[model samples]
Target: MTLKAGSILTGTIVNITNFGAFVEVDGKTGLVHISEVADSFVKDIHDHLKEKDKVKVKVLSVDDNGKISLSIKQAIDHKKSVKPIEIDWEKKNTQNAVNFEDKLSRFLKDSEEKFQDLKRHQDSRTRGYKKNTSH
Candidate 1:
């Protein structure tokens, strides 16, 4: 069978080196780079993968020489479906109402203070204008 990217296939570890492990998959062979073996740090390939051991591998790339590169990490990291969290709509609405009320009250109080300051400035200007025009 033709192997494609993201394809998961069973393979036997044929060779283990300091760099990586060579795996035979579906009559074809590929190299699992040392970095693509596991999630955690691996000092040695022999510490994680063993010779003649069966493992599930994901096809990573194919070279010009038809040399295929595989990854055991990708296969292990396939995402499983998970249900989304449910929220309490009633409680959320109540909390939102309280927050909205607090914010609106603060805004109104600030606006009233600004208006009072503006009226005071306007009254002072009006008095100054009257005094100049009267003289």
Candidate 2:
């Protein structure tokens, strides 16, 4: 079969090196660079790959020289439909819930009471020091 870019192919590791690994696909050879061995850092290419190991690889490129570049990490499919975590903010059925409207009303009432107290204190302080009313 003809190898093409962005195509996934099954291949066997023919050789391993410190910098990369060579794979044989459809009787044609390809090189899987150490950086393409995985999505993470690869300190030693041999630790992640070995000779004669069958692996699925994604075709990165095929140059004019017919030398194919492959990626083992990109071959596997990672597309999964995932939903965000849904949270119940309020217990509508429960009687113990503090509703938004109720909370707002309570806050307004408390603010009014505090304002009245502050006004009373200011009035009391002013009462001690009377202002001249005669023009």
Local accuracy of candidate 2 as per-residue lDDT tens digits, 18-68: 889999999999999999998789999878888999999999999999999
lDDT per model vs. reference? 0.89, 0.90
Q: For each candidate, C-alpha RMSD in Å?
A: 5.1, 5.2
TM-score of 1: 0.58
As for candidate 2, its clashing pairs are: none
The clash count for each model shown is: 0, 0
- What tens-digit string does per-residue lDDT give for candidate 1 at 1-135? 898878999999999999999999989889999999998788977889889999999999887889999999888744563356898766557787899999999999999999999999999889856455654
Best by TM-score: 2
Estimated TM-score per prediction? 0.58, 0.61
What candidate 1 gets wrong by more than 4 Å, as runs, is 77-135
Residue 89 error, candidate 2, Å = 9.8
